[model samples]
Target: MFLYTENFEGQKEMAMAGLSRALAEDRVDRDIIPLLEKINALDNYFTTSSCSGRISVMEMPHFGDKLNSVWLGKWHREVFIEEVFEAIGRHRSGQLWFLVRSPILHVAARTMDDAVKLLNLSIGLGFKYSSIKSVSHRKLLVEIRSTERMDVPLGEDGELWVSEEYIGRIVNLANAQVRRFKGKLKRLEDEIEVLEK
Candidate 1:
């Protein structure tokens, strides 16, 4: 996937470009409306932070970097693989985790690897990201987290963490996962049936 950023484009617009690219790919067969919803959840964070007053356009600069860049990273890009990137030197690496329990995901995930590559990274929804460490799954049975990026305490350098909120926004991700899963399983079942014929 390629990255595209515009001077005046908004977050949704930038995300839509990625969504459109993903949707237009010939390799993507099944519908992605549900997955798109999951993607939209990411945008919700912006609105929530703004409304909750946890974030401000003025304070953003002190917290994160490059808030104005319109990122157009591919679904499989790794520039922002995880909440943070680890690795000495100029290279940084991170992990992407999602609940594959959804039936739809089962199908779409047939050819997918355990991890997703992300790029066109953006920071600043109100959090301090310095010397990013690791991106591991949270302890929740059905939820996930970016172990590295977190909310800092009263005076700490960084301690911010995104969990319940992120999970809540992505509640429907499982739907697509389930749908894809079942679809692929059905295809396999159909192949078996054809083989018998």
Candidate 2:
């Protein structure tokens, strides 16, 4: 018999409620909604958090300083060069970076077996960074992620470092990454129903 974590049903309920709240607030990524819903519909899995990935221009005091970081501009879809320039224009202090991140999904599984199954599926679907995030009596968490990412330092303080042509080049690259991940997300959505079986 498969053993689930203690209060698994209760935790799933609470997580569903949180997802509902995020949806109502428009805080959930639009592209990831269908995938999250499908996972939540399954008996053994529920998404705790997800991002369909993003391209952004950000300002921070230093690298990895998320607490003080500010998004000068962010997009869930392909971005244009003009949009990037506008975001860079807003950067006044601290480090400026052009970033691209692949889709990420955090799922809570009912059992360790369920977690492993999902993790393997995710990795097979090109989420090479997928892994079992945590394991305990409380929950088995699986993190579905991809390796596509870029962190290019644009400038610091009020100075501009790169030329417009450089920005344009990165914009094209970021768009390509966005298309690649979106394709992966689509494939995952198509295959996720297999988990229900």
By TM-score, who's the top model here? 2
Models 1 onward score TM values of 0.21, 0.97
Tens digits of per-residue lDDT, candidate 2, 130-195, equal 998888888789999999999999999979899999989999999999999999999999999898
Q: Give the TM-score of candidate 2.
A: 0.97
Q: Report the lDDT of model 2 for residue 22.
A: 91
lDDT of 1 by residue, 166-197 (tens): 53344344334334344433443333222112
Model 1 misses residue 177 by how many Å? 1.5
Off by over 4 Å in 1: 1-98, 101-160
> What's the C-alpha lDDT at position 174 in model 1?
34
| Error in Å for residue 142 of model 1 | 30
